[model samples]
Target chain A: MMIDFSLYVITNRDLSRNKTIIEVVEEVIQGGATIIQIREKNLPTRIFFENAQTIGKITKKAGIPLIINDRLDIALAVDANGVHLGDEDLPLKYARKVAPHLIIGYSAGSICEARKAEEDGADYLGVGSVFSTKTKIDAGEAIGAKKLEEIKRAVSIPVVAIGGITLVNLPEVIQSGVDGVAVVSSIIGAESPFQATKKFRFTIDYLRKGKIC
Target chain B: MMIDFSLYVITNRDLSRNKTIIEVVEEVIQGGATIIQIREKNLPTRIFFENAQTIGKITKKAGIPLIINDRLDIALAVDANGVHLGDEDLPLKYARKVAPHLIIGYSAGSICEARKAEEDGADYLGVGSVFSTKTKIDAGEAIGAKKLEEIKRAVSIPVVAIGGITLVNLPEVIQSGVDGVAVVSSIIGAESPFQATKKFRFTIDYLRKGKIC
Candidate 1:
């Protein structure tokens, strides 16, 4: 599947909060997220699968491909659009072999990793914790705007700035040379996810027009 | 969860001839494969998940932990013991945070990866494609027994030898110091997965005891 180069949103799989991953996913998709990823941490397999399948069905229905974070099985199970691998995940080439047509993405920690992911045929790179994020307990501090510039200059694929990226900093992230932004709390924990995603979409639209959203 | 240091087997997902994953997994479990990983590289995700869910139930029922070869989502869904992250899968540390108690394993391409896997907090390492096998197409030639030895010496966690491991080459793989063996065609692709696993179980038992099984 060709990746949606616009905006990518990382879905939170906390069944308790999400209650219904598909329901919540539908709302996010409606908010204009082109790509969906299920990044649920620590839950029984039963819970994750049920949630993945539910969300997968919703994302598929929306014509937006759902990507599983880290788990190939869940992605395969839910027939996700593809997978997003972190610096710690499997290499792109091998993952491609596992699911030849999968839209494989890699997280680049260093410029070298970003370049290597491109060399390894990664469809895209999720490149940063642009700002501190509460999603992860110990995310390496922001990889820095300069690091993003170096990585962007080094590769030709889409690079989405992650880690604490939000509407407030969307302008800065885009100026840093990222193709898009990846958000968690900005959408997951937002008062209104729909407005949040639309706000992000507007931000990117403005940026392309040589302004800020 | 603590790993079953005794023996682990890798195989093409048993969804095909076995009809459902549960049946295939139960048969192998009976033969003493403590860990079962689904590595169905060529199938579609929908079919793969159907099969994985079936086997996941079986493994969960039998008290055996099922592992998804390279996908973290499937593992999360089935809550099979953990995930076997190929060099191409997500990094082990993030995987650990996602499934804090889940056994996070890694494929080691070099001592550097193993060291990082450990510091990043990996549970174990699948050291090599012990020998070349048709089961694993285009796999880099076996890292030979030496790479396994070097990895074993370098890491403190238990190591499982992978790739082309089989009964005939069992001795050499075990001698290399890996804690267990993960195989493919040697069992699942064989005419009698039952006998194949028995042979592997016996071989591993003998090797671990430094005697004949």
Candidate 2:
């Protein structure tokens, strides 16, 4: 299964406001989200599993991959397309051993972590808090495009820029040579998730074409 | 906060059947479950968080502590009483650093792991698949009461025996000096979760008196 790294939306319930996560996700998908990751840090296990199953069906129908954030059991339980692990979550090698068929993405804060993730058989890397992020208070200081570029060059696997990614700064992130961008508040917290997603999709595509030229 | 590890019920959604996880959990709590860990391995992040919040409320009102299995983020988000982590989940030391007030339990397969978990500030240790559990296919072989005893001896912290524990084997596990027993299928899978929990609680208390005598 080829996993698309473009326009990946990681869900945050706190950012979704009054809308349910499913509602936000569906809108984003309609607006051309290439991939969806359920990154909620607060839901209880059963609800999380049910949501994954629900979202998995939607993402499957849309022909886009759904990745469960942090929990491997949920990914396997929902038969999700993949799982995304943070630096503190399960190690990539062990996660790979347990779920060989699942696409695994690891959060990388530095070149060392990125290289190790690639060596450990991660399918892709979510590298950042590229700018200070409200989504995760302790995500650390912004790594900036310079370090993101360094990480991109250091690892063989695709790197997705995350944390504080927005339309205003996305062109520079794309210029930094990241394979994709992961958004949280900017999309899910928007007045219209669909419009926000569409704007991001357009910007990403435009930048990629410019890079190719 | 002092956590009562006695009658720790780790939930499995697959085993819960017709009732919701909250319904099953509430039933078990009423039947004398001391600690409740929402161990649904398949829930999506939002659902897991919401479930934890809901269950946390229930557990709190009853004065029974709630532990979220594996995800520290969810545990913190829901203000859960604690978190239970396997060898594959977050490291105990880091989890402690992040959530100093939360009660942390680590699953230990060996004496070394058990001791390390204690040193790393784990509130308790969950040892086994002591009877070969179908619940965790990869839980490996049953470590038996003998290893459970050895782990108990090796670790200064409280030990909770888990995996395939039932009314039949409850006496033997109790004899092994476990501070508590963590159950999945034996309770949640039973026809009446409340009755199953009552039976386990009664046996545990009876065994404790026997040990005291």
Candidate 3:
């Protein structure tokens, strides 16, 4: 796991800046998004490619790499930092052939997938629904903190806990051994996303430091 | 299962017309492509949307519906006939909610996933890697035709054999009791894709008619 969790932000064109998805991404980066994954599953390829291109430029500047979800073509098109693939998406090895050094992330809902992603040369793992979420209707059952700990202990890579994570639940999840939290509606849907990110970052920093920030 | 298994056309973008993908699809439709899934995972949402729009137009003209692969975004974006998702993608239940009337296809590598897919309101199931291929790396151990039979027996829905299925061994696949066959490279990478699809259609017709093409 080359990535250590600080702030894993999943971009949403819907909520956030009410501006271009790219601007919202910039704000998140400004608010301390250490890692960003552009998951615009609905936008046209051109839109995704353009957004990725814009975001890729900024992330490169911010030293944050943008990972596209399930779209190797878009990832390659923009020369983005990397791509995130689910078990059913283009196999990581195949994606690797196309996007060589890009940091490839895999969706690991189970111990089996996490292990496979590691063996397959995944740079990091997005393990989740640390709790059930409406972020994406298809998310697997919340794996619970214990399972997160088990996976965290098992894999040598960084584990980013996703799905329904909020400040209220931050301490428990962090204690469960996750390197960082991947958020959706909580921040993107918030009236003040920057503030929300600050709170999340503050909480994570406090817990990690064993002292309130 | 809403899908007919006599002959199935794996959808392609450029293959819609005057190409091998289209030719194979049309041939299979003529011989009998009971269901057609337009699986172009490469294009952006808009491109996929546009291609699916063209495919939807054509398939509707031919009375055949098209299924988008792992893209509820493009499927809904294009208002295509249906959407197919892999196990690691979104869950069928959620996709069903979003596209109630559209056909929902699920890809499963194990009996457990197939069973889960059925419980999740899946319209059909894609079971595979019956042989290894470059399409999906980290493919499960080749389950072979016999295993397909077992899967067919296990699931009440129609089972479409996928992953590395080609003209060379479709007979054994149908003989194993699969309702349909799904191929990626066989059509996309072929020199004469139109003829290849025609040959597959003829072979399927032969199986149904109790003779070889």
Candidate 4:
């Protein structure tokens, strides 16, 4: 599967301003989020599945790909576009073998892991703790944009930088040669997810093309 | 599928006196465990998948059902007989929809959960921390055999008593009318897993039929 996405938005209910995942997803899509990842670390399975199903409807209506985090079952259950996995989650090869059609995104902290993920048939790579953020507790020590560039060079698959990526540091992260940036708190935590997403979309495009379109 | 296992042995490498999971699985099977659940809470995905595959082979040779604890991907990847889920794991219905051929065991601490699992198509129920033991830290308060009886009555599917079950309490747990007992430390952490399994098998048989032969 060819993964073409920019300004990837990850959903974190705790970071949102009392907005349901559906509301935030709708807002972000209007703001130009090309991809959506439902990353629920603490929800029960039933609620998680329902949320994914509800969000899947919105993302589908907008023609945006829905990515489920750390759960192949939920991804398969809700028929999402892809499933994202970290080091502690299911390995990429197993997920590929089980669901060949779904785009599998692997989280890589180093170049070695990035190369392995590509070899293991991951459609894309999410490389991060890029700027030391608290959104994901186990995201590990901040690897910095320097490491992101190194990893992007090491893997052939599309690399999406994640963790602590805000407007201030997004330029540096974008300049790291990554294909995209996945934001959690920056968009979901903003006063207006729609406006936040529009700004992110503008910044990402501006940085990539060297002009404000 | 008809899950007819009496002695359900759960593998915990940490308590295995440095023995590998494969070693403990082989020992327990020889001693007469009818089913095996590969429960690796801390193992990375690759190693966990490898262990499940290796253990799957042993269980297949012996014609015993192999269940992966809390990971549906690993169970599906290695073609295990089932995947056991707890409150925090993937919900039973989603797993059933994805893998209908695989048995789905659900952990239910109360009758409400047990009845819900049955409605959701769980093949069996693991009702426990039947007694207070250190094997499963999250097994919660020891529900005792009395609660097991109540849960067993509330559901039609087979119920397996787990957590802190020992030979001394085996009669009470069995007398609670549970179909089987899933033991962790009692078997994996025993000095002689084979002998311990033999003892469990004999006791379960004797208690159920009131005869030695």
Cα error, residue B184 of model 4, in Å, equals 3.1
Per-residue lDDT of B16-102 in model 1, one digit per residue for the tens? 364344555666788889788877664533455566777877777777777777667555654567777755455465566656777
lDDT of 2 by residue, B67-142 (tens): 8888776776567788888665666665676568778888888898888889889988889978988897225679
- Pairs in clash, predicted candidate 3: A1-A157, A44-B46, A45-B44, A45-B45, A45-B46, A138-B91, B11-B38, B20-B193, B20-B194, B24-B197
Better of 2 and 4 by DockQ: 4
For model 2, residues A38-152, the per-residue Cα lDDT tens digits are: 9877565556777888899999999999998887767776778898886556656656765688899888888998898888899999998799887882246789999999999
How well does each candidate superpose onto the true structure, as a TM-score? Answer: 0.52, 0.55, 0.54, 0.78
Model 2 chain A weakest 10-residue run by lDDT:
A86-95
lDDT of 4 by residue, A17-88 (tens): 989988999999999999999998757656788899999999888888999997788898888999998877
For residue B1, model 4's alpha carbon misses the true position, in angstroms, by 8.5
Locate the minimum summed-lDDT window of 10 residues in model 3 chain B.
B13-22
Ranking by lDDT: 4, 2, 3, 1
Listed per model in order, the count of residue pairs whose N, CA or C atoms clash below 3 Å is: 24, 17, 10, 0
Question: lDDT at A183 for candidate 4?
Answer: 92
Better of 1 and 2 by lDDT: 2
- lDDT digits (tens) for residues A1-213 of candidate 1: 666656888877552254455666777788889888888765544467677777877777788877788666556656678888764454456566656777887887678888888888888888876777778612366777777778888899888778887767777778877777777778877766777788888777788787543
Calculate DockQ per candidate and list them: 0.07, 0.04, 0.03, 0.37
Instruction: Quantify all predictions' global Cα lDDT against the true fold.
Output: 0.72, 0.84, 0.73, 0.87
Sort the candidates on DockQ, descending order. 4, 1, 2, 3
Winner of 1 and 4 under TM-score: 4
Better of 2 and 3 by lDDT: 2
